[model samples]
Target: MLNEEKILAILRLQKCKAVGDILAKKLIVHVGDVVQIFREKTSHLSKINGIGKHVLKHLFTKENITLAQQELRYIQDNAISYSYFLEDKYPQNLQHCVDSPILLFEDGAIDFSNKKIISIVGTRNMSSYGRDFCTKLITDLAPHNPIIVSGFAYGVDICAHKVAVQNNLQTIAVLAHGFEQIYPKVHKKYMQQVNENGGFLTEFWHNEMPLRENFLKRNRIVAGISNATIIIESAEKGGSLVTADIANSYDKDVFAVPGRTTDLYSKGCNNLIKNNSAFLLNSAKEIVNMLNWDLKATPKIIQKQLFLDLNENEQKIHDFLHDKGKQILDVISLECNIPMYKLASILLQMELKGVSKPLPGKMFELI
Candidate 1:
């Protein structure tokens, strides 16, 4: 816990209309302390980059302060737990995201020390194929003990959570609304099990509703808090795709299970795989191999296939990396004469074939 004054100040900053997470962070840093931001002169705060009069107008309002005080009271009374973005206890992966929430309200037994975190997201209209894949994926990955993160909504999200709980893995549900109520009403039954297993996380205040925009905004947390995001199933357009895009933006691995072309719900995932926005996911082994997860038990000794069939572009990129060692994505794109957009998908295909591995700083090397 944070002290009362500091918590109130953080809440006030969150309530400020003009100040988003990124701008709020800048304000806090400029003022040096959360509490001091409230005390600093509006004129002085205006000098900071991105902090204009509009932001100050909302920042110093009496209404926001009152709201903050009420929220602070609710927090104190309910014993609500939270994590500040700057704190060590905050989700490590999410901290790297520039637009991540400045504060996260949490409930239940959430522990991020176990770094094997992966987000599973997909369409609300999950099919039997999607459900089977989600269950089997978690069951297979149980030995590795990865934390399963999802939106905790209907379909794939809830299925992932239930499977994680069944397999005795911690599962975190990133909520769009506040703690006062559960969205979809039907999911309330699983709340106790989730709390006992992993718990719910949200950035919304207690009284906030599960509005359309909140779910979209909440996708960032679902995307950024994990090392990779998996889309079990999706249509041509859905929030899971949005989460995948955000994960890619953060340079995290994204996976999508392939399906028949005629399947309605598989379009988004197929498009993602086809465009190279996500690696084609066949099994949990692919995720383990890509993420380099180490199992406690002796690993299975499956023989590596003698040769991987690579397309012309993949072969070119592969040979380039094979000769020059690890190279940045841009250099590879330029040297191979492939446009960056097309090259990203090609590289992802190469990775899925187990012929290449992505490194930090957008570097790639033949595996």
Candidate 2:
């Protein structure tokens, strides 16, 4: 059974936006005694080093307690499960975050601990090129079977999720709002599809809206969950840059596909490349080489045989990956002339067959 009191404790702590580890340390006198503070409402919190009467008042106030209970019950009733920061099932990658969410709600069957993960983020008012790049990039990376992570907003975010699901790749959308309701009603179909394909994740409980600030708060998860972030397109100022900045802060690699100099959408990306904030990538092959990964030589295998198992579109990917050696998703899509949406599924089958591998920097390598 879930620890109800502990759950309430987490909800209480989340109100302050304090780091989970910091809160945990300050709430308990010692490591062994940590669970006690969460298990019961006691004066122990008041005795903890940094905690004050003011903080405690907010935590134990009648209104706050009522709200916490309501949120917890909604989660429990919906069968939405969450793992506390120290719980075994919590995302290990996010565990190191200074402001890591104390409790994360998940609604999907996919495991976050799966092999490789990458996040793709960009502006909401994306250009045609941005949309195209998102499709193709994910398609090429899909074969490596990395879990795709994003914020699930409009533009590149929704595009990423669509491609990921089409490729049969597991995708996780970390939302800023509570799980009680999805923010954009337009994404209802996509959200339902993702539940069966990957899952929806959030730190909020129920009935939360996607407020402007909430989206910003959610950027941490997008950066924290993935090994790297691929910025397909952005403007001078937008949410895409926010994710990129967060990714850099987390010490994760950021890659951008350069666009025309005059294109406003490309300005942010080109600036990133110019300022050395990101690597200028044109192919997954370059990304693979940067990561220094080489699939060890094996018996000469029949390439056409692998192609035979794939659909016409999938076959194109097999040929493309084989010819390109290893490349970024954007370049491959251009070279092969494949649509991003159609390419995702092809990559999925290849990943399952060990024909390709997704790398840390949003690149894929052919086996």
Q: Per-residue alpha-carbon lDDT of model 1 for 156-218, expressed as tens digits?
A: 999999999999999999999999979889999999999999999999999999999999999
Q: List the candidates' TM-scores in order.
A: 0.81, 0.74
Worst 10 residues of 1 by lDDT: 295-304
**Residue-pair clashes per candidate:** 1, 8
Q: What residue runs in model 1 are displaced by over 4 Å at the alpha carbon?
A: 295-367
Candidate 1: TM-score? Answer: 0.81
Best-performing candidate as measured by TM-score: 1
Backbone clash pairs for candidate 1 read 276-345
Regions more than 4 Å wrong, model 2 = 16-35, 38-50, 291-367
Lowest lDDT sum, 10 consecutive residues, model 2, at 25-34
Give Cα-based local distance difference scores for all models: 0.89, 0.73
